[model samples]
Target: MPWGERPRWARWVSVIWIVGFVEGTGAHLLDLISGGLHAYHAWPLPSQVLFHALLVVDLLVAVLVARGLPSGPPLGAAVMVTDLTANYQGNWSGLLHEPLAYVGVTGLLPMTLFGLFVVGTALPLGRAFRGIVRPV
Candidate 1:
């Protein structure tokens, strides 16, 4: 209720982002744990760094959004943008040239969908969080 009226959509957006980040955390954790810290060694060093950073940013955004912090929307948007870039960079060949071939490729579809969701909801979320106060 701290979000006042017109918060229904905000709540839905927050939950969607939380769920996405939680899943991202789990996935990145498994990837690192299974392949060690250098799991993405095949990628360029910067790309590898980006992949590693995903774990932290994903978790951070989730916490920020859950707590009704004002930074959630923008930060979430940035995370998704960066994540989508990384994914696209690695998969652009198949994605651009053979789009249908990537219909069910691992985490690609979900990440893209969630990224689009974050982008579409960013403006509304920004307006909503402009005056949000953490509920006691």
Candidate 2:
């Protein structure tokens, strides 16, 4: 099938990814714009830059994935994992000293799981949606 023609489920997944990318990017941008560098003073300069850069890269990958690029999802997943790690470190309040602090941050876990799901299924999902495999 042509790149424009993809299965409905695949399209839905792509839309979900795009929405996540927008939300994630928007949140970061809002913080930077509204609160400025002081908002991220909790993290080091390099860490802040790295996290934002990764977000931009993830957004680009999301666009490619939405356009049916076969490699996009796995790459996005890797980016998401790295982003998650950065978030964890930035928010770290002594995991060993206060294990409950980790649980206080709920968003990271679900997002990580979703990213893993995308990575695990990317190839088969891409093939299935492109009509390379029959729908089961």
Candidate 3:
């Protein structure tokens, strides 16, 4: 579809995923830089691996979605869901004791929000991405 031809819903959904991946890329990068390989030291071995893997996966999916590939949204969805699960597993008990911890900006809040966004818009974002013109 032409830029002006795509529906509003598609355009909005596209913005949502694009912004998410772009920010995710930055967050993972910074985590790696500041914490080296031990940023997720609080997490289990598997979660730590997944967290590290996102440093590359987030950028890859961001590029793919920027290029308008239809495959990006599903991959993004998978990343968020898995990350959320791992984060909850790692932090649930601690956060439960301090209810206000859930509101922390760098804590589970952003991940939870983004995961919710991906869950809500995954299908529509996939459709939107397919119609997006691939970035040069």
lDDT by residue (tens digit), candidate 1, 1-136:
2444437778888888889888888888888999988899877788889888888888998888888777888898998898889888987877889888777746688788889999888767767777643442
Per residue, candidate 3 scores C-alpha lDDT tens digits across 40-106 of: 8888999999988988888877776666677877988898899899989988898889978589776
Model 2 lDDT vs. the true structure? Answer: 0.69
Roughly what TM-score does model 1 have, to 2 decimal places?
Answer: 0.86
- Per-residue error at 104 for model 2, in Å? 7.3
Clashes of each: 0, 0, 0
TM-score, candidate number 3: 0.84
Model 3 deviation from native, Cα RMSD in Å: 4.7
Per-candidate RMSD vs. true structure?
4.2, 3.3, 4.7
For candidate 2, the TM-score is 0.71
Clashing pairs in 1: none
What is the lDDT, from 0 to 100, of the residue 123 in candidate 1? 69
What lDDT tens digits, residue by residue, belong to model 2 across residues 20-91? Answer: 766676767777787776666778787788666754776787677767776677777777777777777766
Better of 2 and 3 by lDDT: 3
lDDT of 1 at 82: 86
